[model samples]
Target: MNKSAYIKLVNGSAQTEITLAEVKKLFEHYQHMTSLTGQQLGWDYKAAAFPYTMEEKEQGGIPYLLLNGNQTQLYHYLIVGVSQEEETGLHYIQIVLPEQATHGDLAKANEFCKYLAKRLKGELHLFNGRIIYYNPRK
Candidate 1:
């Protein structure tokens, strides 16, 4: 199941805000903690992999992550920005899996989403609108 997942940081009353610093910190942590290498399949293509290092880039002042590949072309990325919703205006971060993403990519995305939500005091919103990483005890 190749799908996207969002990590949204909400303030009191679900107001959206830009949390660039925190998001950057989270990205840095992800980079430090993960080390995955793609498998060699053939001369032209490689197996979809995970834990890829993402580079920070900005377009129109919005920050996003680009999966870094040494020899292969990659399209997977993570975007960090504010949500467009008027009522919930919240800081939104998302992991966009490439269309060719494999099961490993999906698992990694889910794992990272959970980690990010816990660390940033955020919540994971799946593409289907299902929420995760919420601690009912808290």
Candidate 2:
């Protein structure tokens, strides 16, 4: 089986600073995505507890989330897709799975994304830019 995963940005101190409710929402969102995707695809989805981070440079600082995961291929997709920062904060919360997933698996992933986008009341960004289904070249 091909491994596949999803990713997004959660609560952070970038704009207004992170809050309890925001943090709770982030976790809840992750759980929802994981459960939904797992149920549909028959794969175990894991959540990364560590928040994405970036090292501050001595001069101008560039912030980033240093996410590490078991699936290296999916890791790249997750980092690029869900780690986007808006003017105030992140675009969406991120979740990731294995890269050994199939097309049907990704279809199910999209469903979870749509569900999250609706729940978060925000736009769901996928495939690093395009608004279509995620079809990264393997």
Candidate 3:
């Protein structure tokens, strides 16, 4: 089984989906671009096994291309899973850690999740099921 974390929007029923390019840009902005690759999804990413890839995946009936490869710390690939339709405010994006994830990976993932949530000004659901709000300070 794989471990996972989530960065959900606090503003309920606001957005539709989180885009991968946005996540990649965030990684680049935060100097964490090394966390994910620009390789094509389902092709170069898995075969390379290079820890992470920025490739977007098109899931069944999904309207948006999944974003961000887990340092931006996914061992294989990162997917943006949507559990709802248009108004997927919460549960918008999930960081599904690869099965090969370890304690160090989890730690890094948590930190990454925190950073993302804080930057996005949303809520973070940790792997342990703890919810932390990332509202702007002040």
The residue ranges of model 2 lying beyond 4 angstroms of the native Cα positions read 1-88, 132-138
lDDT by residue (tens digit), candidate 3, 99-124: 66555556556766777777777677
Top-lDDT candidate index: 1
* Candidates in order: C-alpha RMSD to true structure: 6.9, 10.7, 8.1
Query: Higher TM-score: candidate 1 or 2?
Result: 1
Global lDDT scores for all candidate models = 0.57, 0.41, 0.57
Worst 10 residues of 2 by lDDT: 50-59
* TM-score against native, each model: 0.61, 0.34, 0.58
Query: Which is superior by lDDT, 1 or 3?
Result: 1
Residue 92: error of model 2 in Å?
2.5
Put down candidate 1 lDDT per residue, 17-79, tens digits, no spaces.
545565667666655444222223332222233335556777886766665433243333433
Question: Which portions of model 1 miss their true places by more than 4 Å?
Answer: 11-16, 31-50, 59-61, 69-84, 133-138
